[model samples]
Target: MIDDDAVGGTRSQTDVVIGGIKQMLTSGALVPGSRLPIEKDLATQLGVSRGSLREGVRALATLGVLETRQGDGTYVTALDPGNLLSPLGFLADLQQPAHAADLLAVRRILETESVALAATRLSETELAELEAILAAVDDSLQADAEMDLESFIDADTRFHRTIARASGNPPLAAVIDTLVGRTFRARLWRAISHRGSVRETQAEHRAILDELVRRDSERARIRMAVHLLGVEEFSAAHADEDPEAS
Candidate 1:
């Protein structure tokens, strides 16, 4: 079909431009912060039309590989792992509610590793900070029937975020940050609907924190994994109970 041919031609041209830029980067001819040659010049160099080159540049920009400065030119980004992996969060966010468990599974894997690293790396001050967060969480729990769901959720998120930062790996922390945001609404709903779950989750947090304080990396990892698994199970069981909840 003519439309198919047109689509194929566009794809081919984009691929050519992408390949050309990649070659330049790999060869160190286009290092981070290096401005791309003017579009016309670059198109001529790659033997591609300007339109194709622009499309390739836009794609790379979306992936955080390139940045277009206003009134300036496109340049290579710092190419940090966090920046490059950020697009993964966008994709994860797009997943259907039926796939919530899949996202939790991934979070479990990453957060388990992060907790393990934090167990060994967290300083005494950081441990104290975590303890303080747990204390606030407990206070909220003790409020019982009067518990503020939003307050407890805030403390819960801060607890996890603190541990993620203690892991000393920005990329891991960044991924966890995205996952936490994506699941926030679901988690809040769960806590509001099932008040008993708040106590259980706080207990799990205490156990995980104890392991971290003892510098028991393996136990911390296991505790984190177990805690996340419980959350995933709860979410899965109740996902079908309310189709519009998430």
Candidate 2:
């Protein structure tokens, strides 16, 4: 019985319902963990059909802004910007090969700043942990004559994540975390397919770590930028040759 016009009307109503909920959040009338009014009552209040209201609620839930409990109710989430924005990882994963360079450019911008901040803010214990991570990376490299791609990638991710955490900004760390997650798979593939890249990347990581340990914020920032840019260049070159690799 649902015609095209009916579907269009429902979509519009869904948007209105979404807007109303956003406004409530903005006005602080609906804080984190606040249970929404029952579905029927909320639909009536928003002057929307239950179907439209449900669609909007489902969308919000998917974005991590809301959570629904069976037999309980939907409630606003903790509203952590990090949680809400995690879907960016999916977008990053879906990016076409042509967009690889663009993604790396963003990583360079964020990670340069993060490394600079980490140089100044990282404590002795944190520095020690980073050293251990790199040491493990080295050990993994020696584990096999060829190269242990999986182990290296794990250590690589841990190294960057530790630095991000050391930067002392939760939001920035969260963003960098997502970017790293999105790109690490491609990075691993690039390393596996290209000879000498593994060693080169390990050297670069060591240099960046040295700068961080020296507490030279500017040097750490520059080294980090250079390291990421090298990866970007490698990806660009290979992507042109094999557009379907990643």
Which candidate ranks first by lDDT, i.e. highest?
Answer: 2
> Scored by CA lDDT, what does every candidate get?
0.80, 0.81
Q: What are the root-mean-square deviations of the candidates from the true structure over C-alphas?
A: 4.3, 4.2
Per-residue lDDT tens digits of candidate 2, residues 54-119?
A: 999999999898999999999999988679868878766776666777887898899999999999
Task: Give model 2's TM-score versus the native structure.
Answer: 0.86
Query: Candidate 1, residue 39: CA error in Å?
Result: 1.9
Sequence-dependent TM-score of model 1:
0.82
Candidate 2: where is the Cα deviation over 4 Å? 1-11, 182-184, 191-193, 243-246
TM-score of each: 0.82, 0.86
